[model samples]
Target: MALEFSPETYKKFEETVNRYPKKEAALLPVLCLAQKEFGHLGQEAIEYVARLMEQSPARVCGVVSFYTMLNTKPIGWHHIQVCRTLPCALRGAERLTSFISKTLGIEVGQTTADGRFTLSEVECLASCGTAPMMQINDDYYENLTDEKVTEVLASLK
Candidate 1:
């Protein structure tokens, strides 16, 4: 079957378009709604957004690829993004990431078997002063030590 937005979500799409001078300008938020509805930005979601926005799939995809918050594939409920930038790395980000991977038993970019967590190595999250920081879903975790990270992950349930 063809992909589509629910009536409530379609209303949101319309509202988003109404706020913009052009549908093109609403691409980002519309795509966000689509992602929220579908769980990830799959091919069908991309194509659907493009068709709705009167944009080519390539253009929609380009925008999707440029944003780290957008996911092209399914991820776990808790998406853990560890900073791999120089500042974080210098402050033991690499080790923190390794510890997370080991604790979750999944490599970076892999979701856990239970589908509870997905680990990713991301660029700077602009928390360089804290360093060794990570972003779990929408929240930022900073000034982490191995013990702190473990505690945070344990409390996620």
Candidate 2:
């Protein structure tokens, strides 16, 4: 189906278009807005954003695939990003990843079968002092113990 924009969305698009002198220059912001609105940029959404920006899907897809923040598929209700940098890894990120994998019964880069959680081993999140930390969606959790992580997971449901 061809994509349709609501009045409010059209207004936002207008704003974005104004932010940059050229329509092609607003592609990233448009894609980011779609991610915020739709959670992730699937093929349809990517193409829609490309059309809105007068760009090709291949160009948009290239950007999406290059950036880890731009997810191509639907994630779980809770997206967990475990820091795997030097500090976090030294503090037991491997064990923690194993623990989460066992608990969620899903490996890294995979969401739970029921689609409630996703585990991803990410690079430094700029929280080196708080080694062994993770970010759930947009919130950061630091100084994690297995018990603490388990409790947090239990509370999500």
Candidate 3:
């Protein structure tokens, strides 16, 4: 079977496309909408977006690969992304990541056995001032200590 957006989402997709001068210029946002609709940009979703955007699947895949924000595969419910840039590193992001790994019993790029969490190390998230921060799903937790991380995790649980 082929993949497609829901009626409401299709309306949103049309509006998004209309906002851009060229349909191709809407590729990124369209892909985002697809990702939200499908949960992740698997091959079928990529092809669907490509057809909708009037681009080739390879081109759509290339764009998906270029952006870390776009997920090509399924991720756990709580996507924990740790900042590993210089500022974050200086602020003990590495240690924080290790703590999270040990706490979650999962390594970087790996999801928990229960599929509750996925740990990832990413580049700057534009929170340099709040170095040593991590993004859980859509929320950011900053200025973390081991105790604070524990509290955050417990709260999530």
Candidate 4:
């Protein structure tokens, strides 16, 4: 399809642009729309978005890479990002991440063969006070234990 978004997406992009004082300000929202429609901001999609926004690919690429929320590769139905910074690490985030990988039979940055789950080791989820945090989809789990993670995964269909 030569890297194109739906007409509806384009319409929304226009509306988003109109909402902002500067078209460049629409970058984030339009990029968000691109992610929603494409599921990731890989090279092809980044190029397309840059073209849509009249931006250089380098500019758009930087934006995509800056956000952990943006995916550059295909992911699973469930995206699990475990915080691996100091606090979470001390709280056993590494163990929890290892546990999730072992339990799920897929390592970090890899999706299950069935595409059910993807595990990532992120820098910080901004929940140091809670420690040992993991963000599954939009929900965050803090104070993690192997048993807790097992239970959480079990509940997923």
Candidate 5:
């Protein structure tokens, strides 16, 4: 089926649009709704959102490419994002990421064969104090050790 939001999502989108003085201001939230419905914002979805917002496809694509939170391709069910910023790096985030890659048998930016997890090396998760953290889907697992990371992955499985 073609990518489109549900009727309920359209209602939410309308409400979001009303919240903003300009329809362009609603682009991000509408794009978010489109992504949630379609799982990823491919070319089709990007253009769809652009037309809905009365904006150019290039403009929409630019926004999608600029944001780390936005994805242009399919990701696994559990998107594991490891923070590699200065604070996280100082706290062994790289080692932790390596451990996860080894454990999952998939390198960063690759999804596992089973389609259960996608590992991504991201910039920062804003958890500087709780460094060495990886976000699984929406939940953050912090202060990771090999054993703890293993336990977390096993629990998800």
Candidate 6:
């Protein structure tokens, strides 16, 4: 079946488009709406967004690829993003990531077998002051230690 947005979401999409001077300029928010509606920006979602925005699929795809916040595939219930920039690295982000990987029994970029968590080593999350930190779902856990990671994961369950 062809992909589409629900009536309410379609209305929001229209509103979003109207807010922009050009339809092309609304690509980012429209893509976000599509991601929310469709779960992830798979090929169908990308094509649908392209058709709605009168953009080439390649263009839509380029935007998705450039933005780490956009997901091209489904993610686990808890998406754990570890910052790996210089600031984070110096503060033991690497160790934190390794600890998370071991605890979850999955490497970076792989979802756990039970689909509870997905681990990713990403660029700066703009919490340089926090240094070693991880963003789980939408919440940020900063100044992490092994025990803190365990405690956070436990609370999630």
Q: What is the TM-score of each candidate against the true structure?
A: 0.90, 0.85, 0.95, 0.88, 0.94, 0.93
**Candidate 2 Cα misplacement greater than 4 A, ranges:** 20-25
lDDT tens string, model 1, 2-97? 889999999999999999988899999998999999999999999999999999999999999998878999999999999999999999988899
lDDT of 2 by residue, 1-157 (tens): 5655667877888899899978888888877778877789999888888888888899999998886667888999999999998999999998999999999999999999899999898889999998999999889999999999999999996
Q: Residue 46 of model 5: what lDDT?
A: 96
Name the top TM-score candidate: 3
Model 3 lDDT tens row, 87-108: 9999999999999999999999
Off by over 4 Å in 4: none
- CA lDDT, every prediction? 0.94, 0.88, 0.93, 0.89, 0.90, 0.92
lDDT of 6 by residue, 1-157 (tens): 6889999999999999999989999999998899888878999999999999999999999999998778899989898999999999999999999999999899998999898899988889999998898898789999999999999999986
Alpha-carbon deviation at 47 in model 1, angstroms: 0.5
Which stretches of candidate 6 lie above 4 Å from their native place?
none
Report the poorest 10 consecutive residues by lDDT, candidate 6.
129-138
Better of 1 and 3 by lDDT: 1
* Error in Å for residue 124 of model 3: 1.1
Off by over 4 Å in 5: none
**Pairs of residues clashing in candidate 5:** none
